[model samples]
Target chain A: MIREFSLNDLVFLLEALRWTVLLALVAAVGGGLLGLLVAILRTLAFRPANWLALSYINLVQGTPLLGQLFVFFFGLPLLGVNVDAWVAASISLSIYASAFLGEIWRGSLQSVSSRQWEAGASLGLTYMQRLTHVILPQAIRISIAPTVGFLVQLVKNTSLAALIGFVELTRASQIITAATFAPLTVYGIAAVLYFVVCFSLSQLSQRLERKYHAPR
Target chain B: MPLVDLADVHKSFGAVPVLKGISLTLEKGEIVAVIGRSGSGKSTMLRCINGLELVQSGRIVVDGIELTAPGADLNALRARAGMVFQSYNLFPHLSVERNVMLALKLVRKMSTEDARSLAHAMVAKVGLADKLSAFPDELSGGQQQRVAIARSLAMQPTLMLFDEITSALDPELVGEVLRVLESVAEEGMTMMLVTHEMNFARNVADRVIFMHEGRIHEDGPARETLSAPRTDELKSFLSAVLH
Candidate 1:
């Protein structure tokens, strides 16, 4: 049987692209803010605070995002929590991104030289004052490129959300393929959409990195 | 009464002794130059005064404030004792003016207008008024060091510490930095300098202190200590430098 590629299937995939991008943005912004807090606490907090932050990072990073999504979507109802697939996907993806981003930010913070701290302290700045005024400003410069690069990873990772039946781009492709019995054509379209989104982000990230490095 | 005093101060870093039974005093407005070979405890002694390096034993008092005490306000003490590092550790992200203004705004709680005016005056004092908007990486080594000096001066410290401030600069750049320091000393700011510039020690310092094996081996007036034949160590040190 000769099968025809339908414009209707293409339209469905294009509509699903909006959800994918929305989920990725929510994950990036929500996770980035929480990750900044975690990174700051991990580095600057005393014993118990540091321990708590470390445990949080370890728990998130140790388990798979798929497992977390399953727990949030399937397991939460058992505990009197009733969140739908979109909310579960957003929360799960955000937690997952926070772990990785937190680690990245902590490394950036540590990369700043000890002499900078000494200089700040010798100037009579309190610990918080030094961090806000001296250390974080420099660290933001060192961290920007890597942070933008991480967003591309975050965008691609949103595809995993399709496993929980959220009807994102990948899930929509599966539905279209099931209806028309044309797996290769539907999946190829989905792949191209993802490539376009992620490739553009990657290009933007590279441009930012170059601008940061360019001499004044 | 002495403006600064240390009584048998001792410091060790993981079993490596840096300062051993170091005791000294400086009157108010006195310019003391500390000279020693590398690893002879000169820098450690200066750091101990500002509580940057904790002393294992004995006491250090600055302007009647006990630095070795557990309850001392270290931030307050540091506010009074400004330090100039060899690397000119100005904040790279801040402009030269902001580098000078930071402590004034944060520690002193000065208003923005007052802080800006003081920072501007300080930048001019360092002879970098035109470079006020420049970042540390944009300035020459000497300019950066001068900005570092201006940053310290903005705090209006009672005492200043210099840890080989000019040693990191190019030879041609060294003189400009030393000239800024000389002007600071001439203005009667009390300073303790750890330096290799023998001529500066002889000309600008009120007293000269030589350290050997983590102890003060010689201490006296600058001219007598630098020029006269006192001990075999001092004679050999002078000869090594002069030759």
Candidate 2:
């Protein structure tokens, strides 16, 4: 039975938005930690580890995120591995973020010159020591902008959580519109919520870029 | 045995042979200059001395360690062998003092206070006492090269390899760096350099080695080699570089 749209419906959408925000936060922290390891491995030039990290990035980035979500959500249950939608969505989204963040950070690491490596080597610092004391500090400085930009993308990509039945903003809004037959009004507000979150993050990345990019 | 002994060390980059069976020995406190045209493998030889490049054959022993042998302690060998490059590859992101102190802290495990004091002293020795807090990009090319030298010197290496360190400097700036080299030589620091400055080689180097086609064509006392060349390659090289 069709029901009339009311203020309660908007409140429900806002409540669902909390999950979206939390998912993005989890993805950011989790993806950042894992991606840094991946990025470092990619730059280290160790034959096996480097090749494995590259293949991992390629496999994740080459396929659709939706396909990744299905593997965790729908496909796992058929093999008797029961994963709830919340866990499945989190896992897939984090892996997606890791792939992109790893690639972005790898670029930053490589931007540090070959001369830096030679200088560090001449100083007799071990490869790990050089990375920790010399290379990474510089890479982290150059990486901040693109890293923050990826976080903004992470925030928007969480709308896909709806597919796994996570009941985030998009899913909640869709639920409300089906009952009230108010698709435009319900979805427009959902769109606005995404815009607000994404716009602020882009602004944050820009501010970071300006702060670090001083003219020499 | 000499402090550094390369017994016919051969190196190639993929299919291209760069250093063709080169052997040399360096005694403590000796300043030897290796002069040659570009692609004569002078820089590659300098790199091999410090294990920057691996050899395809033959042997290299530095500071009692066989670098070409498996299980050689290259990092420990490199600890005592310092090198300065032609491009003056200073750590652009770090301050002059930080650049100098990086190895002391990381490799030597020196405390910050000790590293700081020693780095400041090295910087002063290089005549960059005023540029301690400045980034490399803020310094002139010559000053940056000196900072690179200071960075290597802070490690207190027993031997130094300078691969045309002053070649990238301006004509006016070249004097300050050469002066630093002269002082280092006088202080009895063992050094091997590849340079184009004939007068500096004649005056400062105890010996001169003229390389052609990846082999040493002439090796003798600097004055004798500069004044009286034995090979046609040396005569032509001296005339071309001088003129």
Best by lDDT: 1
Q: Write the per-residue lDDT of candidate 2 for residues B1-243, one digit (tens) a residue.
A: 799898998889999999888988888888999998899988888899899999999899887889999988888888899999999988767889999988898889999999999999999999889999998888999999989888888899999999999998899999999998898889899999999999999999999998888887788999999999998898998899889
> How many angstroms is residue A69 displaced in model 1 relative to the true structure, after the best TM-score fit?
3.4
Give lDDT tens digits, candidate 1, residues A31-144.
Answer: 998898889789874988799889999999999888999999999999999999999999998888888899889987888889999999899999889888888877766777
- In terms of lDDT, the poorest run of 10 residues in model 1 chain B is B229-238
Candidate 1: list runs displaced more than 4 Å: A1-8, A44-64, A71-83, A181-185, A199-216
Model 1: per-residue Cα lDDT over B13-71, one tens digit each: 99899888988999999999999889999999999898888899989999778999988
- Candidate 1 achieves a global lDDT of 0.89
Each model's chain A TM-score = 0.90, 0.90
TM-score of 2: 0.92
lDDT at A85 for candidate 2? 81
User: Which sections of candidate 2 miss by over 4 Å?
Assistant: A1-7, A40-51, A179-185, A206-216
Task: Supply candidate 2's per-residue lDDT for B87.
Answer: 93
